[model samples]
Target: MNSASDLGALAHPAATPAALPTFDDVLAAAARIAPHAHSTPVLRSRTLDALAGCELHFKAEHLQRAGAFKFRGACNAVWSLPDATAARGVVTHSSGNHGAALALAARTRGIPCHVVVPHNAVAAKMAAIRAYGATLHHCEPTIAAREAACAAVQAQTGAELVHPYTDARVIAGQGTAALELLGHDGRFDALVTPLGGGGLLSGTAITAAAVSPATRVFGAEPAGAADGFASLQRGERVLELAPDTVCDGLRGLLGAPNFALLRAHRVEVLLADDAATVQALRLFWQRAKQLIEPSSAIALAVVLANRERFAGQRVGIVLSGGNVDLDALAGLFASA
Candidate 1:
């Protein structure tokens, strides 16, 4: 991967509150990233639908650029920069998909991109980030370590920090998926997505609130890393935990902005365990003929675990990513 240590600081325009993105921003993002990001297809599975008792409309974000919906947010952040600042570069800290997605987005703009990644992040995802030509800095898996490392990189490199989930631009970018999904033909009763740092879920909530107010927005999270669920229950954001789930991408604490927006939209969060996620992964692969990472499978897991919530309704699910490490596949399935 190529590295540019010193692109030199450049002036960046400040964005005002009025400039904050709304549903219209999501529509614009779809147009902005259309040339680069794929408008991934919506999939269906008769067998799975019968099993869950819901008509499922799966937004195949696993087929998205960078193999995840993170690309949407990353693409927006990279493109939103002023020409002078973009020339200087962009930086972020991520467990995996966000970093890789940002790197891919930066590559298109021909700018320097630096990623501070947790050491425990998936190996294949790390390789993907590096392969996209971003400079990598390893950090302890804790949120503090990732933030400190990312801050140091930005200070040293003069790269704008496009946080994995907290930034408004990222959230606006992530919403475009649902905009497209909900904009399609039928009326959806509900929309479900895996909640990690809550970028995808936050965006979905924002878009659903505007376009389909009647459609409930649901967030599915791992039981082992259920702070997001906990936060939503307590009516506030919560501290981080040392996550112990197979969904590596969903381990982080909920971002404050994400928390606030989720509350604003009254988004409902559902929890699923590692075993249920594993089972969902297998079912998706076998029935849909599609491979989704454990993080992505959590949405489906929640749906199956609580069949009544989505029963006899048209529900749309955003399959977040498909960047699982190949070597760990057998162990993941066998252990479950």
Candidate 2:
């Protein structure tokens, strides 16, 4: 077993502020990911805009290769590794999509991949991870258990740990989505994305800060798992969470580096109840004709909930993922 000090080192924030990736790094990541990642389309819905009272630009990352924006970070992390280190393969702990993303990324590079997964992860995501040929190590849902499992795998296989978030390379990779989103003609007043570990939100915030400083970045989170909201308010990373939301993908603990980036960029965190998220999920499906997870739906939910602030403005949203389990949809929505 790893010592408490070792785990503490892994959990704590990096000391130097320079650890955050620069805008130039995001640009480099965009070029690096071009071969493996897709430039997901920017979609607009007349009905969605009318409902939200804003010109909504949706970055359709759900249609990405691994069914989420996570592939951007995962692919970047995998390829960033030196040939010698990459040959040893890679490992990580994830609730679902990140695991699947990393697994697929490793496959493209002809490498072995291992993932430490919680038993409660969505079935469809778990299936996708295995389909990508990654060996799965099941563990309890708690962060401690997940990290321990990941460490064990790393120790045994000599694999490099590509953390789901908090890594500079991963954050840069996640920022590439926003780089592409901002590359379009319109200038957005606010951009929103679902926040979990803060990889996507931090990356997006970093990109927005450089590319479009006037644009405010918003993080939509489940009220039941409102760590991001709590952290931003308290000015520190908060991990004590008893997540009880239907958006399984947004339940991960907030990341330290991710918290620092959000703070630096002054990103706003918004909360929505599980019921509202479900309602928004249906609204997105009906209006935009896109099948997104409850996590992604929450991004639009917060904006719609605060329509007055965004009225007659331009808004950009990252439709983060679409890997929800169809079989569990009935029960998930019924709970709300």
Candidate 3:
């Protein structure tokens, strides 16, 4: 992957320090999205915990509205807009989860929503976006194409842009998941969440920093889509790479503001290979009796892979989403 020395030169500009989301924004987002977003339950599995040699607290975001934690950010963004701006509508580019989430959020406010989706996006997720009453404009599966499509849609519709990950409002909204998890119990030794565009992980890190200063924050990334890991290691954003992973939800490049927040909080990222992620997915389904997508399962895969880091400690893992295409389940498990 090619590294960008100037993070601001990336597609998304680096956020100014004052524009970055804070714990206060997270707190406000919790209240703003309280009525729309679900306070998903935290689950436990003794068998799995024993296998990993750590106490696992699963924040079940798969049960969240629109079937993912993306809803929290989407809902917050949709609601935070002034009435005049909201009336103009909202637009975003998402592979799947965020598209479906923005659609649902816009519906709640009775506004027009447009999603710029890649041609190669998961069928189930595309269906979900359409089902939620959003206009879907298909584009090639490249960042440039997606952004161009989104820009065109915004120009034509005069819609406000609610970027999937980089927007401060979205980051604040995403933080609510970790906020809820930490609030549900006492302090945890560490918190882990899947890292895609860094929205969820950045939000989690911010929440942990403010609420539980001692808790370490970790990001679980698919080895195939390890730009977040590379970016952190090199102290610059890695902007070029073709992600080759079964974790479809994590294919996006890490956003500039998202990277900034993560770096500021000193977040560590761990990698999980596709085979291990699939195995972790199967384990969660069979042992926890809960169905989670490969993207979500990677968090557990990292924990299991690095047992020494988390052994005998309480760890919170955010199951980011559950919007997998049911038709492909057999193929995914068969490979594992």
Backbone clash count, each prediction separately: 0, 0, 0
Where in model 2 is the C-alpha error above 4 Å?
Answer: 1-18, 119-123, 140-145
Please provide, for model 2 over 1-336, each residue's C-alpha lDDT reduced to its tens digit, 9 standing for 90 to 100.
Answer: 112211221343343434678788788889888999999999999988998888999999999988999999999989998999898899987646788899999998999899887776556667888999999888876657877887898888889988777888889999999999999745889999999888999999999999999999999999988988998899877766567678877776678788888999999999999889999999988877889999899999999899898899999999999987788878876877
Clash count in backbone of candidate 3: 0
* Model 3 vs. true fold: TM: 0.93
**Candidate number with the higher TM-score (1 or 3):** 3
lDDT of 3 by residue, 92-201 (tens): 87646887899999999999999887776667667889999999888876657767887898889899988778889999999999999999978999999999889999
| Cα lDDT listed for each candidate | 0.83, 0.85, 0.87
Q: In model 2, which residue pairs have backbone atoms overlapping below 3 Å? A: none
Evaluate candidate 2 by giving its C-alpha RMSD to the native, one decimal: 4.1
What is the per-residue lDDT of model 1 for residues 183-217, given as tens digits with 9 covering 90 to 100?
A: 87457999999987788998999899889899999
Candidates in order, TM-scores: namely 0.90, 0.92, 0.93
Q: Cα deviation in Å at residue 331, candidate 2? A: 1.2
Better of 1 and 2 by lDDT: 2
